[model samples]
Target: MSSNRITTLLVANRGEIARRIIRSARALGIRTVAVYSDPDARSPHVLDADLAVALGGTASADSYLRADKIIDAARRAGADAIHPGYGFLSENAEFAESCRRADILFVGPSPESMRSMGLKDQAKAIARRAGVPVLPDAEITGDDPTAWAAAACEVGFPLLVKATAGGGGKGMRRVDDLDTLVDAVAGARREAASSFGNATVFLERYLDKARHIEIQVFGDAHGSAVHLGERECSVQRRHQKVLEEAPSPVVGPELREKMGATAVSLVRELRYLGAGTVEYLLDDRTGEFFFLEMNTRLQVEHPVTEEVTGLDLVALQLRVAQGQALGIEQADVVPRGHAIEVRLYAEDPARGFLPTPGPLHLLEYPERPGLRYEVGVSAPGEVSAYYDPMMAKIIARADSREEAAAALASALDATRIHGLVTNRSFLAALLRDPDFLSGATCTDFLDHHQNLLDPAPATPTVVHLAAGLAASVSRRRAANPATGFAAPGFRTLAAEMLMSAVWQPVGREPIPVAYRLAAPSGDTELVLDLDGTRHRFDLIDLGADTVRVRYDGVDYPCAVATHRDGSIWINDATSQSGWVPEPRLPDRTVLAASAAGPVSEVPGTVVAVLISEGDTVAAGQKLVVLEAMKMEHPALAGADGVVQKINVSVGQYVDAQTELVTIGAEGEA
Candidate 1:
């Protein structure tokens, strides 16, 4: 067997987490090894590691989750230990045992502890043994439909069918009605089998509106354990955390002490050896919290806790794994201030959060005090579909929650990411939301407050005018590349320069904007003709993809970028606005929102077809259900019509905007 000390560590993970672990390991002067799939050959994590090994295939299952390959890679690199770094195989008890058999150190709890905590059903029983409060749940007996049917009735409506082994919102489905119970069970089973290799599921009563609070607990080989604090992870979409904060807004000292004690009790009972998080669903009305589950590995939102507690958790994990006792006791642990984090994903929010797989042509971040960026990819990289679409985690810290919120919002404004759509604007809006500021956040915060997520209207005279002016400046730079001269819209003398351009927002038609420009008095001025509404503004090109424009007596700081196709994009703190040379194409009439011509917004397998051919349907009736990213989206009938054709079948995966069903007026054929 190898020594307990870790000399070289193999990071069995990818993306932001790999980089995060590498940073801490590097600080300790430890050599780090990285493993990659085919799609991640050029990933930043590979270059940052001292040695990288190809683990074969492109998908996570073929590379990161393959215990044999990872152990082989660690041996090939002559590594002393393996840090699973959160996701793939991080909590897999079998993999931990494999590492032990191969004489390599596993930087986590013992395999027995992982087995006890990996399954929610068994973990709940363990929590009960530790006197931790748990939710009322029923286990499914075998795969019998009758058993599940009986269990469903006992648990009641608005319940969740969760995988006995699950995390990250996968392997779960919400059953709101009895009619949907069977489908939800089947779907959840499929996802559970595919994601965790475990089809065992159970029924848990779902809380309508609750706060997700998790306590960070750490233990060592000596059996001494302590709790850090609580983190609020209620702000979520698609059942995944989008924003998190340390020292929860609502948790007082009394509640914090209680939650922390319960978590520490569990850790000590398990004899856990490293970083772990105990999650609970806190009832907002009653101040009662029930144990949800325990993650036997580090969480994605651990940085927020680190910011407030002022500790490098990954470093601590390494030390504990080396059989060293925790340096500080519970009394030594203290939280300084508030810390907030938001996940930036490569997803198109306007298109139902569809993953946009493409290259990142430009990636710029906000650099300021109290702002920390734990990123995955830099500029000129590809965001593939083989893994999670999360690109970076932006964390901000301050003495007060309001100050932290404002600072993070400002930083988000200064950041620019192009080549693919992201949820940056949605996160910006969240920081500015009044309800969020007032701490009225819960599990369904996004579900109830979707208006805040929507971008401001792209119409009105000023918006169109701003688009035109921004486009003109970008076009000028593209032409000159040296100076602002020699461009079609540039004016050498003080004369009005009439310029017109078309701007097309994605999923919308082209908008033609005409404006006049002049360089009078050595200052650039633009007069936008908004259908006879003359609005004047000053435009200044700040080098390095930034523009400062004065409009309506207010200066707008916009990060601007020119794509390879000559399209201009602009993003600010709260809204993302852009423009491009409108293409001269055939015009088509737009359909009403209730029209049936709208296509699917994301690529997913057709799980259920609710309508039949030649069947009359209401305008809002469900036509088909598609499953993508482990979430279900229903295609509704946009207009009252008879179903003409169902173009997809169950188990068939279809791309975005693919025609799943066709509807026509009765007897039209």
Candidate 2:
């Protein structure tokens, strides 16, 4: 075995994973180089690295997915090794081979090992050979729709058309019947081509009720490998894992050993090297597990396993890449306590979990014991439309699963994220859910509990009042000199003339607040009238961005922030909310503009135009499809109408609220 060490490591990825790899490499005294697209020039990961290289494009195809560009960057940066951080070229066998050709160590398994498990069909076949149980599946070999449908039928009803080249729930579609099978296959192929550069896909029987259990495996050049228990990632949306935990709630020690041994056997058969995860689907009713696929790179949810086992998987990968021996044996491996991780994404749960990329006016995570934050973006930064919408991964560890879940939920509640819609509230709600608490979670967890996807309960009236008062006070403070204050927002005609302002909570109607400030000295009192109702509050203290008030004898402390766009954000002990100040003079032109037809909800590139000008469409019919952050979102017609104009075309980039199709009622023109 060679004794070469990685001195300068180049991370060939972006976002949290890049930052994560840099952290581990830095701790080991390795200089890290970060590669980024044009949009990620100033991203946190790029800034965190010791050196940065620009790939010079906005989209992944033009930047991150360019293997040649990455290889060039590594050579330019004089990197000794390249770490593909769990996406993009992380599982690309050709990229790994390119690294090998360049004589730069790829901190992962062998390229041959990757190819052996890269394709789902091939991997399943290999698993069967290794005595690992696999689900029934059929490979899609041709472009013929009849052949594809025949393969689906062979796999049976309610099957999944999955891309052979990628993970992370991309390039996959579920077809329940023959009618949609062809379209599903076509969509999956397109998505797979876009994401993995491989349009090849296969069919697998869908498991409606199953637990996603993945065994983390590690191997070295010296022919030793061990499994680091399992992580249950059943809490998902659109087949994408949202929450993950270590030591699955359903697996006992015996089952864990059996699964782990089975996973280890497969890796050992391939003589796999570095960090890898062998995923499996454990049937909820049958208590049987089937090999799903093997991710030839570090998994996104590796932190949960790290938290429970106290092992740095990245460090291990680095060591393995250095041709080192597996320092510990299977008998030495032990997992303790429990760890839970939730992916905090810049997305709207109420709106089909669509990605919402925008400025993050305020991004703050509560500091507490047992809480670990792997943040990808920063406040004053924007979630670019070019990459994944995940902002951070929040993990909590405790003595038991219940405590870990509860702590994570509370921490999420305390986290202050503003300026864009997110799934933070939904994640917290799911964590605190009774079924989740009881460990009764499966792949269909979100499907069965659809209520969690709804918008969070409206911000309480008191919170809104506090935000309004805070905004008013801030405005007054800024308007008046520090020494000339006669109490913030105070009027000389005090009681006779109350200050009024209009505040609107997000997704709610405007509310008018008429408030009077009292007590120029101590314990200020606020009298507020809202909707013909009066309420009184005792103002204990007011800081730059926080307010402490006594409403109905209950002390409420709220943290408030105002965006550059005049939007106010408030976070209290229970909930977080955002408010926009109603303009004093509404724009008549905007009010007169038609609010009709289908519009893009997020910024993306139009991938498909399903309707042309003058085409008659029914309600809920997909008129256009936009691809953003590697996910497809269709603009559906709101009502039956004839398309008046097709404003967008394929390959056109658009912003949020950009009209894609202008539809008019029949004979309206």
Best by lDDT: 2
TM-scores of the candidates are: 0.87, 0.93
Candidate 2 whole-model C-alpha lDDT, 0 to 1: 0.86
Q: Which ten contiguous residues of candidate 1 have the minimum total lDDT?
A: 586-595
For 1-669, candidate 1 gives per-residue lDDT tens digits of 646988999999999999989989999989999999998998999999999999989667688989999999999999999999887899999999999999999999999999999999999999999999998889876767777888888888789999998888877888887778777787777777777899888999999889999999999888789999999999987678999999899999899999999999999889888999999999999999999999999999999999998999999999998989989799988888999999999877666677665667788886898999999987877777667889999999999999999998878777777676788878878898899999989998988887866666432336434644555565666667675544333565435556766666543456666676655665566777645567777776633466566777777666666677555666655455544456444332233343344466666667778778889988878788776644566888878888888898987878766777788887777
By TM-score, the best candidate is 2
- Candidate 1 runs further than 4 Å off: 141-149, 457-501, 506-509, 514-548, 557-559, 571-575, 583-669
What is the C-alpha local distance difference test score of each model?
0.82, 0.86
Candidate 2: which stretches are off by over 4 Å? 1-3, 141-147, 454-461, 477-484, 489-501, 507-536, 542-544, 583-593
* Per-residue error (Å), model 2, residue 322: 1.1
lDDT of 2 by residue, 107-188 (tens): 9988999999998888988898888999888989877888888888889978999998868888899999999988888788
For model 1, state the Cα shift of residue 305 in Å: 1.5
